[model samples]
Target: MPKAYFEPEYLNALVEVFHEAKRILERRGITHPVAVDAVARRILSLAQEGVPPWQILGEVLPPMTPEAAGLPEVASTNDIVVSGPAPDTER
Candidate 1:
């Protein structure tokens, strides 16, 4: 069985592109254009770190508001706010 969230192969390919981009930067000794590729690499790294792809996407792409995380103000759920930490499940 797979984890509830799985990072796709295309995402891995993007990471590779970033890697290649970095080499180019180092070769040319110019990192001015590195920011975009660097950000891509960071998102890919986060995805590899076991974060859900959706979460990674949210961090990378824009128009992402606190609402998307199911925060109370957006979710219309008064019983519990979806913001803050994930609820403790110990009890």
Candidate 2:
């Protein structure tokens, strides 16, 4: 079987999306892992569509919580490991 690969650009996009998702979750005061995971998945989908990392924050995420409005904004991208390419469904 041939080995699978995650394209560099795809990996980068996924990383950026994850970062943005984390920030949105933090700003919303969402500490639940499940909720954060759900947001991360959505961010990946949007990132796959070539949505800008910064733009994804405003377009796809839930509105900022009132309490979060007063919090200082922080942004950072972290490294992510993509185990491998998605399995082919055509088989």
Candidate 3:
């Protein structure tokens, strides 16, 4: 398959946007490699379509909840079930 080549200025813009997006994610405690790579791919896709860096950032980083930010879910009291010991079945 033919590789897509970008002009130097466009390539620089893409790189800048990618790094900026990554920094934003990291600030939000999203340092996972997979998440970073996914953001990079998204930035590239948008950049190829002539999207501005600010727009790319806006589109890529939506307001995410703790779950979406890769943080562990905290179980609420309603979500927790307390079970008593099982009664002897042979009694």
Candidate 4:
């Protein structure tokens, strides 16, 4: 594969996208460092391919389920919490 070259503007845009994405994940209580890094890297790659920053971030993060973005879930009468869904529960 040939080496990919990113222009200065794209590089700057990528940096901004990475920082913003990381901040968004942090604000949403995504404390896993690896998860945040993975999303940031995905956003960077998407930005390099000419995808807008907002779209790139959206691809990795789940959309707000009409309740409001990043808001804590209000436990109602039927709230269920799962301990671990699979064998490899660590992320």
Identify the leading candidate in terms of TM-score.
Answer: 3
Which tens-of-lDDT digit does each residue in 1-91 have in candidate 2?
A: 3222235745765576678678767766887999988777766666666665656667767575645577665556676767989878996
Clashes of each: 0, 0, 0, 0
Output the TM-score of candidate 4.
0.54
lDDT of all the models against the reference?
A: 0.56, 0.67, 0.74, 0.67
lDDT of model 3, residue 9: 54
Name the lDDT value of residue 36 in candidate 2. Answer: 86
Cand. 1 TM to true fold = 0.33
Residue-by-residue lDDT tens digits, candidate 3, 1-90: 323425675677667777878778888888999988888888777766767655677788876788867899876756655699977899
Per-residue alpha-carbon lDDT of candidate 1 for residues 1-91, written as tens digits (9 for 90 to 100): 3343234655665555456545644544556656756666666666566666545544554343456545566445558547788888998
Candidate 3 ranges beyond 4 A from true positions: 1-5, 63-91
Instruction: Indicate the residue-level lDDT of 26 in model 4.
Output: 78
The digit string of per-residue lDDT tens for model 4 on 1-91 reads 4223256645666677677777777777887978987786777676657676556657867665746774677767887777866578678
By TM-score, rank the candidates, best first.
Answer: 3, 4, 2, 1
What TM-score would every model get versus the actual structure? 0.33, 0.48, 0.54, 0.54
* Shift in Å, residue 76, candidate 1: 18
